[model samples]
Target: MDFQLTDDQRALKAGVRELLAARFGRERLRAAVDEGPRLDRALWRELGEAGFFALRLPEAEGGVGLGLPEAVLAFEEAGRVLLPGPLIATHLAAGVVDGAATGETVVTAVDGGGLVEWLAEADVVRGEATGAEPLRSVDPLTPLHRVPVSGGAGLADVRPMGSTGALPTAPLTSLFTAAEQLGTAARACETAVQHARTREQFGQPIGAFQAVKHLCAQMLVRVELARAAVYAAAVTADPVDIAAARLLADEAAVRGARDCLQVHGGMGFTWESDVHLCLKRAWTRTQRTGSATESEELLAADLVSGVGR
Candidate 1:
């Protein structure tokens, strides 16, 4: 089947990209990272006004009534710009909130699968009241706190991670995260290619070297492969398909960042370079909804068993 993006999809991508380029530029992203775990309230409000957070909700719910595919396009652009914050959680919570359509409310995810501690930033937190527990997150951008719940029949309680089964939201969130990674990977590839073409060494362009060419080609392959899987998952909306998408996307993110760094050589390792930032974000996001290994194992099991359900 043809997998080309429709005209509307292309328009959506272009719109989001332009918005991000204007509002969430590289300087703003670096400032947010430097400032610690706090989100850019002004940027968030701007995004809200632009309907970035309310794209998935129904029109009656005060949203633009866009579907997941559109959400994926917007999120892909967000990833390319390394837009920080718990974007997926915020958007998902917005869908569940009462007056989120008009961008009147804010929402965040509850840690430990407990009572979602809708912080000062959130007008409401969506989750079971008892499932809340206080927890700290490694990524400063995603503020972490507890959700207090008595107990439940699931995984560990100390740092109760939300299972894909316990919270049906995991799959969708994972897919969105994957889509973001795909975007990042693609951008990273572009950065690497551009650098190789411009950076001269030994009286020749670095891109002319066999090693650099191979790296760039490999990055392209990873990005395209991941894009295919992500697009398939976005179109199908099947949990199993999402498993594969997550695997490919995570691989692309991880490898693309590394390859881009390699192409940039020493410069890629510096703080000023955006490659490391992309790498860090990719590493953090890969572990968000679930581990890459877990996703791979799940996909492998399904393939081996010929499971089509």
Candidate 2:
């Protein structure tokens, strides 16, 4: 299978990036951070108009008539900007829930881990969120709530009301989450390299130092590896492939952010810089949909069973 993005796909990716850069630049990002966990309805509607949530829906249904690859590309851009909202849920709800495709409605779901993101702000909740306890999230943008697990059934097992009977399957859900992680990893790599080239120490650019150079190099390597895995999984849409991609992406995002911080030295730790926010977002994403432990276990099971043979 050709993993290279087609011209149209590249255009779509570029369009999303440009749209986001125009809508949510650095100043807007800091503004969102200051405002705290509120959803921007106008921005959400704009995203809807841009076909972000409807990327996977059939054109006959007023969507972009695209597939997972396109959806992944759009979401990767979202991840780069750290766009705050229940984006995945809204995207999944496009055809099934009214106004979701147009971004007039906000949707959120409980993951297999029983965590609901942006629960209070959602126009629709796709799981049993009864008795949900709000948890303090490491990412200032992603507010979380935990639903009580009952009868050994996960909250994700509960059927959503007023829509399709089932939520997204774990593999697809995890794949999209991996795509977002890939974006964060790539962004961290870029941020680190830019800083390394410009920031000076000891009367020389810090990038000239072997230690700083190595950190930046490792971040690039991790991001590239994760990107390959994520793009491949998006094309394949296989459970095993998605699991592996999620693992690699989680590592890349978390480790890349830390490496970025290391490259920035003390400045990365300051709230004034976006490096720390990337790290926090990466940390938050690791627990979403499929956690690292869960993905690892799934892959281990597949290997032991010779499923890939």
Candidate 3:
């Protein structure tokens, strides 16, 4: 299968990136950080107008009528900017929930671990989030609520393309989560490289140092590998492939952010720097949908059963 993106796909990805940069630039991101937990309804509506949530919906239903690959591309851009809110949930809810396609309705769901993100702000909660206790999230941008873990009944809105798990929701959720992870990983790599070229130490750029070079190189390798896995999984839509993509993407995001931080040295630890935010968001995203352990378990099971073949 050809891995190269078509012209239209490239255009779509670039358009989303440009839109996000214009709307949620660094200044706006910092402002959002200072403002506390609140969704920018206007920005959300603009994304809706851009067909962000309705990317995969059928044209007959007033959608962009694209496939999962296109949606993944769009979401990768979203992750790059660390766009907050229940993006994946709202996108999944586009056709099912009223006004979701238009970004007028917010939707959230209880994860397998019984956590709901942006629950209070949601116009529709996909799973049972009853008796949820708010948790002080590590990522300030993401406010979280926890419910007691139980055998979660599947939500009606989950449109399963081909899920390997007993619950049909994992395929799209895992794939899209991986796509977001890929974005963060790519952004972290870029940030590290940019800083390495400019920031100096010992009268020369730090990127000249072997340690910094190795870190940035490792980040790039991880990002590329994860990107390939994510794009491939988007095309294949196989459970095992998606599981592998999630595993790789999660590692790339978390580890790449850490490596990026390492390159920034003391500045990365400061609150004013966006580097820390990327790390925190990457950590938080790891817990969403299919966690690393869950993906590993699914892969192990597939290997033992030869189900992937």
Candidate 4:
């Protein structure tokens, strides 16, 4: 299949990028990191106004009537900017309630793993099971609580963090998360490459060094490979494909952050540097929504059983 984005998708990415560059710039992002666990509400509302929260909903639901492809593009931009929030949950809710297009509602999911704390932000929380209780969230920007449920309630509560549940909407959310990871990995790679090219060592550009060059090249490879998987999974909407995408995207996110840090050397480790933030965000996100190990195991089981084929 031709993987090229259409003119519309390109425009969508550009628009979102421009908006984030202006509104969610580094200063705002730092403030959120220092003072809040998630992103700023005003900025999120602005995104909502931009129809980002409603892009995947049907026209009848007051959405742009787009599909996962469009949603992925928007989310990729979100990842690029490290735009925070229970974004996946909100979008999943939008898909279910059919009201996200207008930003009038908030929806989140519950899984077998635990109850998510951020459900407090939702107008409605959906899940197969419930194990919820009120709890304080480390990320001040998102309000989280706990809930308790029996059997496969699909949601659970883990303090300082959010709950995890088997989302009825897991496939789509997984694909979306993969897209976000792809964006993060891509941005980290870009940042690393830019730094390497400009930062000199031993009277030569660091990027000219074989080790630095190799690291950047590897980061690019992971990002591109994961991007392909993520886009394929988004288009196909297959569980196996989605799992594959998640696995690849997780690797990209984790590895890309590490490689970016390596390229930056000591500077990457500093609090002022964005590399650590990227790493922390990627690490946190990978575990949530779903576990990387779980996805890999599922993929392995599918492959062994000839299911993924």
Candidate 5:
């Protein structure tokens, strides 16, 4: 089957890409990092106005009436730029939570009803949340808080998503997570290639070195392979397919960022460098949406059961 994106899909992805590039590029990202964990309300509102949170929500429920594939395309840009806050949570909460469709209210949910991001800032909470306790995060863009479900403190507004309950949730969320990972992997590869060409060592660009060339090449390969899996998962929306995609995507993103860091040498580890941010984000996201090991187990189970055959 052909994997090419439709023209409208390409245009939609481009529009989101251009918007994110302008709003959350390196400079803006660095600024936000320095500003700490505060949400950029203006940017959030602009993204909401642009139909980001509502992309996959039904039109009857005050959304744009698109599909998961469109949502995946939009979120790829979010990951590419390393946009902060509880993005996936808010998107999932769009029609369920008040004002999430318009970005007026920031929403958050516990991953497995345990680890919560931006808990205090969330105007609406979901997923058997009890109350949050402060926690530090590795990614400066995404701070952490743990929300235990002992008392089920915030379940009042946490409505179920129709008859699907939570069954259809994982694969859908994994699809976008994999898309985001693909974006980060692609960006990391690009960043490494750019640095390789421009940064000189021994009176010659490092890209001229065989090892550096190989590193860039490997990064590119991982990104391309992960991209294929993510795109296919988006199309299929199969749990096993999404699990496989997540596994490939998590590795590509985390490894690609590390390889990019290697290409940049000492500068890559510094707090000021964008490479570290991507690396940290990759690490955090791996934990957020079913880690590599988790995805592997899911795929293994499917294979053992011969479900996809």
Candidate 6:
């Protein structure tokens, strides 16, 4: 089968990228960081107006009438900029919560266990919410609160977003999460290469160094491989496919960021540099929806006995 993106898909990706570049520039991101973890109502509304949070909702529901592939591209842009907040949760909350599609209401989620993000600030929550308190998050861009489980379920106040039975959301989460990882990984590679080209050592550009070349090449390889898996998962959106995609993406984002930091040498770790933020965000994303271990386990189960369903 042809792997090329259709014209519309390419347009969607470009549009999202342009929108993010215009809406969430580096200075704005730093400003947002200074303000801390509260929701950015203006940015959120801009996303809504842009049909970002409602990409997958049926047009009948006043959404964009797009599918997972489109949603993945949009989320890839968000990831590239490291846009904060409960993006996936709010997008998934579209139909279940009135005004969520329009960004008029803010929603957060309690994932299967004690992991609930933005619980304190959400206008509405979905899942079983119970004892909730803020937990310091590694990615300051993402404000999170973990809710203690009660009777085997975590705390959330909104009704379960199921008509009769809940639709499986793992694949959606995994695909979108992987897309985010792909974006971050690409950014890390770009940042490292750009720095290597300009930052000179002993009168020669650092990029001319054999070691730096290898590092940048490896970063590109990881980013491309992860992009392939993420795009494939966006196409299929199968659980096993998503699991595999998430696994590759987790490694690409986390490892790519670390490698980028190494290329930037001492300055990468400073607060003024975005390199550290990428690493932290990648680390944070590795545990969301499914981590490396979780994804590996799922893929292994499916490979060994076709057990994961």
Work out the TM-score per prediction. Answer: 0.84, 0.95, 0.95, 0.85, 0.93, 0.93
1-309 in candidate 6: lDDT tens per residue? 989789999999999889889988898889988988788888888888899878877787788888778888888889999888788888887877887888888887776545777777788887766667777888878776676656325322334433311436555666788989899999999999999999999999999999999999999999888888888887876778888899988889999999999999999979999998899888877767676777889888888875655
lDDT of 1 by residue, 1-309 (tens): 778999999998999999999988888888877887676767777888888888876777667877777888898899999887667766765655554543556665543333232254566655443444444654445555554445421122222222112336667777888999999999899999999999999999999999999999999999899888888888887877888888888889889999999999999988888898888778777755545776878877888886666
Q: Per model, how many backbone clashes are there?
A: 13, 0, 0, 31, 0, 6
- Residue pairs in candidate 5 whose N, alpha carbon or C atoms collide under 3 angstroms: none
For residue 242, what is the lDDT in candidate 1?
86
Per residue, candidate 2 scores C-alpha lDDT tens digits across 1-309 of 667999999999999999999999999999999999999999999999999988878888888888888988998999999889999889888887899999999988878877889999999987677888999887899999878877224434554422321324566678888999899999999999999999988999999999999998898888888888989988877778888999999999999999998888888889999988898988887877678888889888998896677
lDDT of 5 by residue, 168-273 (tens): 4545666777888889998999999999999999999999999999999999898888888888877777878888888888889999999999999999988888
Error of 5 at 13 (Å): 0.6
Per-candidate local distance difference test: 0.75, 0.86, 0.88, 0.74, 0.82, 0.82
lDDT of 6: 0.82
Off by over 4 Å in 3: 151-167
Please provide, for model 3 over 1-309, each residue's C-alpha lDDT reduced to its tens digit, 9 standing for 90 to 100. Answer: 667999999999999999999999889899999998899999999999999998887888888889889999999999999999999888887787889988999888877667789988888888777778899999989999988666444343345532122325657887899999999999999999999999999999999999899999999999999999999988888888899999999999999999999899999999998998999999998987678888899899998896556
- Could you tell me the lDDT of residue 97 within candidate 2? 81
Better by lDDT, candidate 5 or 4: 5
- RMSD for all candidates, in order, please: 4.7, 2.4, 2.5, 5.0, 2.6, 2.7
The alpha-carbon lDDT assigned to residue 158 of candidate 3 equals 43
TM-score computed on alpha carbons, candidate 5 = 0.93
Worst 10 residues of 5 by lDDT: 155-164
